[model samples]
Target chain A: MSTEDILKQTPLYQQHLSLKAKMVPFGGWAMPVQYESIVAEYDCTRHGCSIFDTSHMGEFFVDGDAVKSGLDFLVTQPIKDMPLKTCRYGVMLNEQGGIIDDLIVFRIEQERWLIVVNAGTMEKDERQFQKFIRPSEKFANRSAEFGKLDIQGPQSRALLNGLIPDIGQLAYYAFDHFDLLGANVLVSRTGYTGELGYEIYFSWDRTPELWDELLKRGARPAGLGARDLLRIEMGYSLYGHELEENICPLDAGLERFIDWDKDFFGKTALLKKKDSLDQQKIICFISESRRSPRQHHRIYDQNQELIGEVTSGIFSPHFKQGVGLGFVKKELAKKGDTIYFGDDKNKLPAEVVSRPIYKQGSLKS
Target chain B: MEVVDHYFYTKEHEWIHIEDDQATIGISEYAQEALGDITFVELPSVGTEVEQFEQCSSVESVKAASDIYSPMSGKIIEVNTDLEEKPELINKDCYERGWIAKLELNALEEQSKLMNAEEYRNYLNTLE
Candidate 1:
């Protein structure tokens, strides 16, 4: 059988087809890559507003004490201190300190919590959670019961306020249950794009209704193509690209999200590699032109010696240039260094810059 | 979709408009549509000799990269420099403004090996 025949479909599959979306296999699901043109959709998301079907992502509900349930030690972040209605971003690691998946923990209440993870790693993450959590604690994979929509861009607030009047009260990284289209659902002021955005989790079957209502409210439909570009522009780490099984959070430049004050899973292994001299490094760069560096593209130093490989790349519509994330040696990844991508036959020059290549985004505004 | 009449096409989806010994080359609309949004186009340098059915340039989209093949053996005399800055022109107008290069043709008889407008349109249907 063909790959598409075996691939799963989201609830919004028909809606995407009606909009002429180019469906591509992603994370075991046949998802839309683009509705119209990728650049046009990207422009709409940056300057106006766009809604994306993020239902492929997985969500789980864990009920018990943070420490007693073993949830605190399963992830590399401090969960006991997370206030109600707030979200914390961190990674789950194996015994060897390798990243299993980067996820978001939402403290719904003092005892109830929600964990959102990548679609590709959902099964593996579930096995880890199931093995670690206490037998008395309740664990449920609610991915099939829910559908997610990411309404992103600067104009998202005004658009959402039309439907949910109290949306403005929720601060960044905070979530609350809100009534939408007669269903009470979780709505969070969070997004992957570096924009003032919100993510809505509604019933799976009724998601098409919500998607239609959002489109009817003047929000355009964007696909994973534009979403990838937006996230790359923000220097966000993708699961398969930046975070991998063999790569640790520290190597992925995510040490800031790790809490040293709290004891967590993989702490011992992570501490052992922390002070090592040859720890691998991840860097972000901006291309001199529109030519983008693709994943697995070779990264070379000024003298033409190979140093690393690109992990994620995109042609940034906002910056009108190519921006990328790559891994290089610790000694060669200094800021303001000129590096080249691609092979010797055709090398493109770029500069190593700080994280978040596009700073003009209204992320905080 | 938009196959220019009187133009010859290669199986690779490259369209060649031959006028006497001078020819112009561009990707077909079908090709551009399949590529989605074009971000960059590597234009062939001027005065480079290219063989028939050989890669002369490349186009990059948001998804992937693909090579553009020459339909006939020729010397690349001129290239569309505008594509360097705005590659989306190929997605917008693949037939006219998106033309990749103009060549001084060396083998005129090689045109018989390519498909005409009707045959190319039929060829595209097979792809679907």
Candidate 2:
């Protein structure tokens, strides 16, 4: 509550307060945690269409050739294979291979790219880009000038098609600029909820005008509470949680995103660490009971031996059971291994299955 | 929030309905609403003895896992096993069908420390 004076407010801050949202300090911002209830808001995102204010996320524009601007070597995922108007998910890493942040690079123009990063690591990510980006290339951190909104759920496509006629043509991981309400907005067919949706980046100052329009279109306002739950159910990686400065992409189960075929930042470190012994890898689990695995809760084996720690967790409303993502010793992280969460006082039983505990989703649909 | 007039309440938001030496216990409506979408309930054993205001069983909702304290000291007589697979009953009917446990009162005088419906209503206001 004391941080209210210092925390930055988005353009829709007043609107959120008017709706009686439960505001919380997130990533140094006074953001809405939930407008109604976390569960109700989550249900809307899964079944019905819901709009989320994600303007706090970072966006930077780069104008130059991929390799010439030093963008290719900066991220782990390969950029040469991406066609125009497509985006790929990857991570920026430190020299020691520690994950700086997970991001999406959208190749909008032939020589231009739009990169989106997490809200918590925006400043640090910008500093890294400014440090590595070479001369003769144009770069702009337009995070402050862009307001992002994600409309997600099974009903998202139909609702958005009513606004943008060509929304159906935009494939997953693709984007296009369109004139909407007399404003040029960048709409991407990508979302974190594992649902059929779009992430719209609008002009920051005039976004509230569009937010009002979207509300009239029957998109209920969801909050960060629902967003977190949705992403967790899909076993998605969050910056501060699954992908931290101390954690590497390999340990985070994101090696598939890394391009070993091409040389990039932290390549030598990654190559060396790949063969290192005793490395812990991230794994997803489902609780036998309804006891949700909370952050920082230690993970133990069936014998009560300590293995690792839980990074993200929630009681999945879709599954009617607890689901969580955690990092455990790679050797002990088996598909059917029974894991327990909690410390000495107690241990909640769970089983390590394949990644993504929630099987029912409309991500690709 | 639904508060039974005849029930005794605790500061931790648990309620108990006493009939002779037998008592039924469950979390209050305010508690259920606060911990939305109850997912799992850890029912206490039948013969366990519990102290007033002490930890009896725990319930996990989508928001959090909270300790359900004993409203008054007693020996657990029976538990609602139905809650194991139908924990949403805590959210649907927390007062009646969602009752957690039944206890045989060991010390009837311990009830004095609890609040009546009127007193509990006032205490709930102080929380806000």
Candidate 3:
């Protein structure tokens, strides 16, 4: 059989097809890349509300003590001190200090937790959890049973408030269970897009109905294409792009999310590599024009010497130019540094800028 | 899907409209549709010589970048400079205003190697 025949499909697949979405294979699932033009959807996500089908991501339920169940030692964050109904973002690392996956830990209850991970690393992440936690009915991978939708924009709160009257009470990164479509649904005030948004998790079978209702409620449907552009504009790291098993969080400039006060899987190795002088760090750049720097495009210094490689890039709709993230030698990873990207024959000049090239987001609004 | 009748097309989904010895070239509607939204177009320099089926210009969309090959050998006489600021013209009208470059033909017989509109429509069917 062909590889496409074995790919997984979400409950909203038929809905996306009906909407004339362009489908593509991503991380073992047949997902929608775009419904209409990416620029149109991107504008709606920034100025208005747009709903996204994020069912391809993996979700896990863990129950027990934070430290005794090995959950505290598994992730590189302070999970034990998290308030109930709040979420924290961090990474899980291998023994050698390489990142395994970045994930979000949601404290559902005093002893119960919810972990959300990338779709590509779902199986491996499940194994890592099972291997560490004590064998019991305390852990379960519910990715197949749940479907997720993100309604994001400055107007998202008002739009969703019509359905859930108490949605406005939740702070950023906070979550609560509410009755929707006759089923208990978990809704969080968080999103990948740099906008006011809410992520809703519901039963897989009911996702199609949820998608339809959102569209009917004036929330335009957006796909992965717009999602990628939104995240890139916010300087967010995606799995297999800005992050991977071979890259550490510190080098990715995610040191703020790492909890150094606690003992974790890669704590010792990360400590030894902390003071390394020649470590490379992730840097952000803005192109001189609409020409974008693509993945694997080599970065060049002022002297025309190869310095690094681009990991993620996209034409910023807000900035009206190309912006990207790349890894470079620590000494060269400075703001206001001039760099060039692309091949020797077509070296496009760009300026290194601080992260989040589009800063005037409604994320905090 | 929008193959202009009487126009000659290449296997790579490019179309050429010939008027005597001068020919205009652009990508087909199928090509533009496959490339979500045209974000940028790197047009070739005017007066540069190009060979048939060789990469002359390149186009970028939100998804990826693709090389636009010349349909017939010639020298580039004119290019659509409007695409520099508004590449979406190609996505909006891949057949008419979206024409990439105009070439002064160097070979007339090479047109025999290309497919007519009807043949190109049939060729697009095989892809599906």
| Best prediction by lDDT | 1
DockQ of candidates 1 onward, in order? 0.76, 0.55, 0.73
Candidate 3 Cα RMSD (Å):
1.2
Order of candidates by lDDT, top first?
Answer: 1, 3, 2
Q: Considering lDDT, which of the candidate structures 2 and 3 is the better prediction for this target?
A: 3
Which sections of candidate 3 miss by over 4 Å? A2-5
The lowest-lDDT stretch of 10 consecutive residues in candidate 1 chain B is: B59-68
Mind giving the per-residue lDDT tens digits that candidate 2 earns over B1-128? 67889999998899999999999999999998777668889999999999988899999877567899999999999999999889989888988999999999989998999999999999998988
Residue A251, candidate 2: Cα error in Å is 0.8
Clash count in backbone of candidate 2: 0
Whole-model Cα lDDT per candidate?
A: 0.92, 0.89, 0.91
Clash pairs detected, candidate 2: none
Candidate 1 chain A, run of 10 with poorest lDDT: A132-141
Complex DockQ, candidate 3: 0.73
Q: Higher DockQ: candidate 1 or 2?
A: 1
Query: On DockQ, who's better, 2 or 3?
Result: 3
Give per-residue CA lDDT, model 2, range A1-365, as digits (tens).
Answer: 47436888888999999998878888778898888678888988889899999989889988888988989988999997799989999999998999999999999888889999988788888888998787734878989999999999989989988888888898888999988888778999999998889999998998898889999999999998889999988889988899887888999999999999988888898888899995889889998866789889999998899999999888887777788999998899698989999889989899898867777788888
Give the per-residue lDDT digits (tens) of candidate 1, residues A1-365. 98646988899999999999999999999899998888899898889999999999999899999998888888888899899999999999998899999999999989999999999899999999989888634888889999899999999999999999998898989999998899899999899989989999999999999999999999999999999998998899998898998998998999988999888878899999998887879999999988898998999999999999999987877777788999998778688999999976989999999988888887778
User: Candidate 2, which CAPRI tier?
Assistant: medium
Which consecutive 10 residues in model 2 chain A have the weakest lDDT in total? A1-10
